[model samples]
Target: MNIAKHMETIFLASVVIVGATSMASAAVARIGHAAPEPKVYAVAVEGAPMAVVTVSAKRLSAAEKAAL
Candidate 1:
């Protein structure tokens, strides 16, 4: 068998496989069933005193914004 012909066959087979797989998955999505909504609950925790934090930064200039 020729190498080129073998590769062509393999590529065509892969294309068919991918197309069928995608179509099947799409059909399944169209027939989707209702999924139960997740139950959520609020959790509370005691707050502890946090140490004072300080942040220092210079405002960006108009030139800096334009460059970005």
Candidate 2:
């Protein structure tokens, strides 16, 4: 019924819950039961910028020629 005792009980319960969760995680990792790898068709190179230019050199649009 005491406040101190109630807080102590709640703190002990939280410690036990966290310990159980950590133990479960360690067991799963030991058994190699982890998240599956994502399927990727292509891998992009690092620090490469992608550009999509659709304007022709000779047949440029009026807007594109003005912008250039």
Candidate 3:
């Protein structure tokens, strides 16, 4: 029947599209996988003397924040 032929054509087209997309995605995946290995970088942090913190410190105003 004509309907069967049409259905066959649609199914074939969808299969072709899916196959093409899967191949393209596989190629893209391979290319994406070729990234350079990340090296561990050693950061030199200088030790700063820490002072004792107390709740007796005065709260700064908005003007103080802007100046700092």
Residue-level lDDT tens digits of model 2 in 1-68: 68786998899999999999999989888998668899998778889877578865588799998999
What is the TM-score ranking, best to worst? 1, 3, 2
lDDT of each: 0.86, 0.88, 0.86
Among all candidates shown, the one with the greatest TM-score = 1
Clashes of each: 0, 0, 0
Which stretches in model 3 have alpha-carbon errors above 4 Å?
Answer: 1-5, 34-68
Error of 3 at 68 (Å): 54
* Candidate 3 RMSD to the real structure: 10.3
Per-residue C-alpha lDDT of model 3 across residues 1-68, encoded as one tens digit per residue? 68776998989999999999999999999888687898978655679555567788888999999999
Local accuracy of candidate 1 as per-residue lDDT tens digits, 1-68: 68786998899999999999999998998898767798868555569555578889888899999999
Model 2, 59: alpha-carbon shift in Å? 34
- Clashing pairs for model 3 are none
Which scores greater on TM-score, model 1 or model 3?
A: 1
Q: What TM-score would candidate 2 get against the native?
A: 0.42
